[model samples]
Target: MGLRGRWGGRAAIALCVGAGVWLLVTALRDGWGRADPVASVFGSVAGLAALVLALRAIPAPRPPVPRPVPPEVPEWWVDRDEADAVVRAVRRRTRRWRSGGSVAITAGLHGAGGFGKTTLAKYVAAQRSVQRRFPGGVHLVTIGRDVRGPAAVAAKVAEETRLITGDTVETGSDPERAGNHLGSLLAQRPRTLLVIDDVWEHEQLAPFLRGAPHSCVRLVTTRKT
Candidate 1:
């Protein structure tokens, strides 16, 4: 029931309990010789009924448990050996950079629109190996046609990451500032994977490219090389 209903029910229960107590007390005050057995029995029943009502009126509240966030990847992905090969190659390249002590590594999957570049990037980002490498998290950001300039892209990334709660970073208009805020949040972790999908131009990717630590790896999917 809603809060109002629950409170109303409790109030009614309290009245019933008070009435029952009064009835029991009055019955006990009267002498047995002058008391009506029916009245006494009714009083006893009322007291019992009050006890039951009080028990049902209040309930213990339970604490909520937070659920784990699910990965952003396609279900029922069909087998594409060629696409898988490219994902593996990119993964290896990122791993090599990490081993070589590179601060940050950026790789791109460039191809025409219909060739499934975004799909391939998703597949790579969702891979078990990639998940293991980036313990911080794997975030995917799509650059739509309307998402012009770096600041807008940074805002989208901030919204997707949810690094800061409330109006901080996400509501900002400055792309450079938003990117710096996002980078600072990501830098707290040892490593993270950022998947930029359907990027049309280099400028669209520039703002987000800043602030990421060397351990962070960026995988971009675009039509441009």
Candidate 2:
């Protein structure tokens, strides 16, 4: 008939075959005609009860969900109120940092380079509330030897912003141009958090922090005062 009907018929045949095999085995082991039917039934019932108890004792493994990519966003593993407060504080700090005046988030993060500043920044950026606040999305730039000048900073920011610096803005053309372009980008957004990690000098903080637009926030994670 149908595939489902065929499967059902096959299953029925398989079950019947299994039962017949079990009966034949039982008869061979205990002389079926000579054995007491009641005793046999009671033994079978007891065996089934033991089997069920054993099955219940064993723990079943949870099934895995197949997906193309795992979610990168952090699930709320903490209390809702605490999470909401953290998000609000972040947004508020973002606003304060973006303001014309210099604002510093001075928390004593122990250790040197190996300290978890970058990780914490990333986690904060990935927060659902922060993500919602900045629909333009978050950009992370790591400053190093290759990233010595303003041009490199612009290039990194452009990359983070998901735009080619040459095609969209000329931050890489010159230091002043790069600074202006970066500032403009930061200012253009309604709410953006610009994080500068592992700073070595007070001068390094000046360009990115100074004269930035009120729209975006600048967050610096530095070792020095």
What is the clash count for each candidate, in the order shown?
3, 0
Model 2 lDDT at residue 154? 55
Cα RMSD, each candidate: 12.0, 20.1
Best by TM-score: 1
- Highest lDDT model number: 1
Candidate 1 structure quality by residue, lDDT tens digits, 24-141: 6666887544355645666566667656655666665534322224355677777677667766665665567648755335777888878977777777776777777666666677
TM-score of each: 0.57, 0.47
lDDT of 2 by residue, 19-88 (tens): 5566677678877873457445645665565555545545564343121121254463333343354456
